[model samples]
Target: MANKKVHTSALLEKAGIPPPESISSSVVNEIQQFRKVQPTSKELVDGILNGNVTALSRAITLIESTNATHVEKANEVINACLPYANKSVRIGITGVPGVGKSTFIEAFGKYLTGLGKKVAVLAVDPSSTISHGSILGDKTRMEELVKDKNAYIRPSASGETLGGVARKTRETITLCEAAGFDTIIIETVGVGQSETAVHSMVDFFLLLKISGAGDELQGIKRGIMEMADAIVINKADGDNIKKANLAKTEFNRALHLFPAKKSGWIPTVSTCSAITKEGIEEVWKTILKFLEVTKENNYFFEKRKVQNLFWMMETINEQLKLNFYNDPEIQKLLDSTKKAVTTDEISPFAAAQLLLKKHFKK
Candidate 1:
């Protein structure tokens, strides 16, 4: 019987199966080692300041973490990086679905990198509402730019964020700037309130549109047109060239009706072909000119200051809400309070007041 047991053990070892006890011990050891070796905030900040991409990615992960334990470290890393950030020209790009945003970004990013500029592309992909799953497929679409040593692309899931931007996008931009990216492009999930969110973070907001659609302005919100710094009619190749030109004319006319932007710059309309790479340089030059004009007039710096203030208030609001919702007392009362409201046993306002009173008691 002992020989038979020994033979069975040998066969199990030969089959590459670990003993149950050993398997459990190995997993515990790995978890312990992982926790032990996690980088400190100082180490992450140092790595990012030295232009380490790995450190940048890790820091971003920390920022995106939902774990309460990571919040302190994430904030420390962000504060350290803040002194070195805001050096890049942040640009926001948005367009409706089927407008070829990925293709345009590939060509545009490659062009910027070719000019010896370090470019970082932050793409927000829509998340599945039901499962919270996201494709995060921008890297696959921007194949050529992905290979460029000077370019970095990050695709983030827009989980429940109203604007289709990752919750930590602003923090990620700061990390990228600390890592020496000269240009940061935030490509928002197809047009919506997301455009407004992107506009808040970027120095320039570019709106890309397509041609030959039945109505030139169909499906595009008028508010979006007003927010754009420049509108580019894309896919200006082959038979589409004429339609693109006409769209540009129509957009130019439409833009004239909106109030002038605070920066004293008139938004321009142009045409481009992402595949053929035509007019890409023209669009870039327009951005540079806008920057120059804004910088000369000091609006550029003023706008950034305003943005910083906006984010500071935004962060405080978010933290307050988090604390309110995550409080143990509040959590315990929430289900009953909600049920009371549903059953019409309590007025919604009265229920909210009661919850607030309970929350403040301790």
Candidate 2:
């Protein structure tokens, strides 16, 4: 039975972690045991000190957990890993389906490994089924890179609710850093508006595109363009080469339509083909340049610090809401408030205030 205790479970149980009470200890023990033999958080911390891939993946899983009890242990792991994390640049990549995101990642991941840097890929696939799992197949798409001992690939699980990113991803990134990865790449699925969640979390946001004859930008979401640190027109080889060049020129023009970000970082447009491995180095170089410029101007570190603050705020807010609403008495009060609103006895805003006051007092 001791073998069944996952670090997450053991840590949570040890910490008296808060989660849905319905979640059985048996389930926690099962997940914990499975992690024990694999490259787990504990192992990864060891590996990261030595730079191991298996350990990195396990650590990512811990960070991605939605279990409330896991939160504390997750934080502990992140704190322990903090000093080792963040040395690697964090980049967020997104695109619609068929934009060659997985392919490009394989190429990009391979390229970074070739340069003697340790690479960790955390992909948020929102469309995965409840039972089957991540369909993007990071390991298969990047078969070559998967074999490299320096690389770690984690596809998002099927049922995660927080915009495809498992709740603990932000924490996971820290663990990856602690484990000594030099470059952390966050890949988001093709969920249109939801991509912003990833954008707000990463240092650099890259939007991948396909070859469009000047018309694609019109179809692109303004919100995504606004958040992108760079726009990459992929599939630049073969027949699409000409179209890709035109698309790049068009995006360059489109980017000028917007003003600079509050941080004063101007997003750039580039092109690459994962099949040929062309322009991959330039993509990596541009990211470094973006970091260099932002860090020099204090935007890099400040932005991440702000993100951490935001993460804390959101986590606290959600936890408070869960704790409040999950109570039977509070739920009854909320139902009564709604009834009052329908009868015009109390405005919604006032009812909310009253409910909060009552909930806290009780």
Cα TM-score of candidate 2:
0.77
User: Taking the tens digit of each residue's C-alpha lDDT, what string does model 1 give over 8-66?
Assistant: 44344545755667357778989888757889999999999998888888889999987
- C-alpha displacement of 324 in model 1, angstroms? 1.2
* Best candidate according to TM-score: 1
- TM per candidate comes to 0.89, 0.77
| All-Cα superposition RMSD per candidate | 6.8, 13.0
Best by lDDT: 1
Give model 1's TM-score versus the native structure: 0.89
Whole-model alpha-carbon lDDT for candidate 1 = 0.91
> Which regions in candidate 2 have their CA more than 4 angstroms from the true location?
1-48, 52-55, 127-136, 158-164, 325-359
